[model samples]
Target: MSDNITSNNPSLEDVIAEAVRSGLALVHTSLPGVVVSYDSSTQLAMVQPIVRFRRRSTSTGSLETYIPPPIPNVPVVWPAAAGGALTLGMVPGDQGQLMWAERSTDEWRKTGAADCDPRDTRRHDYGDAVFVPGGRGADDPLPADAYHATATVLYGATDVLLGDSTATDKVALEPDVQGQLDALAAVFNAWIVVPNDGGGALKAALGVLTAGGWPTITGATKVKAK
Candidate 1:
């Protein structure tokens, strides 16, 4: 008699349960991954899945260990619509989530067609994975100095451009601007511009009375970017 259960077997429910488990294992959804490398030009990344695949071996009744190979050329997700996009600088060792599309994305990726059909009947394929970067461990929290109560904050780089990428006007640093204004005010206060038509001697300069001195123009302490 064969050990494998058939449709006429007494324990039919056991076969059905095992079949469901095997099918569910093949369905790829989402998993945590670490970025191995990123290509900004192509907006693609090489990601190493963080989860280890485990399955019980029938021969020895032991769990088999399998680490998924690094996935390459995975598209990185960015917030975009219409003609505008917000792109981020993804780097190595960045932790993120990997999501597999419902169908094969080969045709869609290659042609950028909205109504394109899958090249094959593959579903929830690992090859169609896209990365969403920004996930971090709870123990490794963001720096306290970078946190803001209400306003949007940008850390690391400070110099900012408000217009197009090629725009020449860059926002000046607050401290630098303040220093320049202070210097100009000092020079103006000292200069004794006496319009002389053969004057005898220079008198005290006409004082430009300010409320106190140069008003302090403080810059945004919370938000900054480059």
Candidate 2:
């Protein structure tokens, strides 16, 4: 029997349930290396293992430098069974911007005292470092130490399992899934990065999704093994 389902019709939960069942078959056939598991309540398919990125830092001058801190190990989770895609939500500090300074000398002549040229100096910003404003909350207008950014890539077999056939169908679904993942990642990032202020953007996004007929996955009962 075919497990394909439409995103607009049979609710997200139903779609995900069917997709998880169908996804196992696809995973078995196409990507044998990846291990697949599911979380019933959250409707999340926990793809086994995690991915990591290398971190490095650079120094521009004595007091100024670029420190690219280590990015944490990320877990890949499918947002929803049907309409959503996998997301590796990473809250990376020091990846966004860099700050630096340079020194310059200026000459001055004294009126009477031995005609001295005072070696005056000034600091300058250079390269991408100039883009980052110094001090806390100085460059980023959001009044937070960190901001949320996301990277999304499509899940090919999952799209096909969701009834995406043509090139256009597959392409069309990519952005939609990517947008949803981005929204969720933003919310997760906000919760971690800006804990002081209430997450207004994340709340608003949830409100919009709730209003738009998106249902929340609540319990393990909803999950089924393929």
Top candidate by lDDT:
1
Return the top candidate by TM-score: 1
Clashes of each: 0, 1
- Scanning candidate 2 in windows of ten residues, the lowest lDDT window is 125-134
Please give, for residues 67-133, the per-residue lDDT of candidate 2 as tens digits: 2222121122334355655332222131122222243212211242435444544344121111111
Candidate lDDT values, in order: 0.73, 0.34
Error of 2 at 55 (Å): 84
Candidate 2 regions with alpha-carbon error over 4 angstroms: 1-172, 192-208, 212-226
RMSD (Cα, Å) for all candidates, in order, is 6.6, 32.9
Q: Superpose all Cα atoms of candidate 1 onto the true structure and report the RMSD in Å to 1 decimal.
A: 6.6
TM-score of each: 0.72, 0.15
* lDDT by residue (tens digit), candidate 1, 1-226: 2233433453766677766766777788999999999998899999998999867677875557789899999999999778777665568998989999988899988998879977699988778899998777888777876679987865544333333344444445678687857756675667665566343222222123233343444455433334
